[model samples]
Target: MLRSPKDPLSFDSREKIALFIDGANLYGTAKTLGFDIDYRRLLEEFKSRGYLLRAYYYTALVEDQEYSSIRPLIDWLDYNGYKVVTKPVKEFVDQTGRRKVKGNMDIELAVDAMEAVEHVDHFVLFSGDGDFRSLVEAIQRRGRKVSVVSTLTTQPPMIADDLRRQADHFIELAHLESRIGRDPGERAARAAERQDRFARDADPEDI
Candidate 1:
């Protein structure tokens, strides 16, 4: 399934592959597809492709919250197969006194990718941010095949044109959903329970 315009299919198994996951980017894509990812399946899917050396997940957390929405997902990934990297999102007031959230993991992702370039044979990035074009180019310069994963189904699509063009292979997120999507019956049951909870907590007028 790993066809490329660059190299032939004669590459060996020791050709190490690494996954650089942009947490927010991947979350948004999955949310758009209406399913949660089965991380175990995702890992197995890639392991079948080649030697998987590492899977790195990067995200910024909102500090000082009583509870964060992403906490459970982060914990799950940490215990699973991923190398979870997180940093607290900084809150600052701009010159106009508007509160702003600053949490960009581009530098961290780039550094890790560069460090792994020496040993990795393939790089798979789970983001569509155009800023990574240069980083992808750097990896390609080292003769590693770079695969970019993001959706092409949305109105404007999630991937940047230049990034898609630069990658050796561009895998759309939709194609991967079947392998990671939750069962529809289970999803409906969960939604019904959530709605029931909301109804029990609210006045009839509020509904």
Candidate 2:
């Protein structure tokens, strides 16, 4: 039997894989590397490598704001085959009376990963947060292969040494730039295509 070019990707016998993208972390990593993520291409590249079970993207939103900076990206991902998880940003004043916002999605991400362990054969994590070291170890103990995607190419590496060491396999994001990064030429076209398209932040990864 021959498989046609139009055959559904799910019909393949490849290992089942799930992607867990820490939105803020990924944005920062890519920013440091000087490129934007072509999320469509990222999903396509992974789908080509396996039977993609799910692609999860986690982020935090400031509900008080009339319009969020990342709203367009979140909406796009939700409509384009991604399971988007979001929570409101928590704002509080510190001991110094300085106001700060906290929106770590670590717990949400961990709980989701654990729940998905039974259904997936491989887990691909896209974040450098050291806190996930334990989560990776836990997932590995459940007999699933875990791949951590982050970069060590920067002056100060984006990935944590502990998390990198804990993963079954470490994939350097820098290596996948050409495959998943958005094209520089497309920036103008994309901007013109949609006024709602979100622009990336110049600051480091947060929330």
Candidate 3:
């Protein structure tokens, strides 16, 4: 059941909404929650909640690799109504002689959110990073409601307290599992599903 608008976690169906997903952070949070997100379902679920203006997904690609595991997902999102933002991954060696990969999309996401504030009534941020506290505050100052989606049921908790405090709403990702999650078996069947679906959807005229 939906809560009253006075509730901290309630969303108004008439307000325009946009989703800002931190690709890596969301993946980690969902993995900890023990489910795979059916992105197509996620889009529909949010669209049902309100007027979904746009969904932005951010990630870093390892361009050096001939095959990146996330490439297929990125491609799928690009074709399926998501505004996908990406950059090349930076490889470096640390002071301790350990290899490291740097790929943070915070600045990109913040800029987009700021620009989107003029049009969106509410912002749904899919990340637990405390670094976004200031960003959330800034958005709120512009009169847009901000919802932080992350989990608090884990051992150490996935959400940053300061970030959660700054948000107008806290949407527990775990609670949304039934609405957005895909069965783990889907992965095992994906290859076959892809082949069959492709053959069925492909047209000879297009080919």
Best by TM-score: 3
Instruction: Please report the candidate that would top lDDT against the real structure.
Output: 3
- Give the per-residue lDDT digits (tens) of candidate 3, residues 1-207: 225323324668999999999999999999998899999999998898899999999998875888888999999999998999998987889999998888799999999999999999999999999999999999999988999999888989999999988998888888888778998788879878988889889996865
Off by over 4 Å in 2: 1-13, 92-99, 191-207
lDDT of 1: 0.85
RMSD of each: 4.6, 8.6, 6.2
lDDT of each: 0.85, 0.87, 0.90
TM-score of each: 0.81, 0.84, 0.86
Candidate 1: regions farther than 4 A off = 1-14, 92-100, 188-207
Order of all candidates by TM-score, from best down to worst? 3, 2, 1
lDDT of 2 at 182: 92
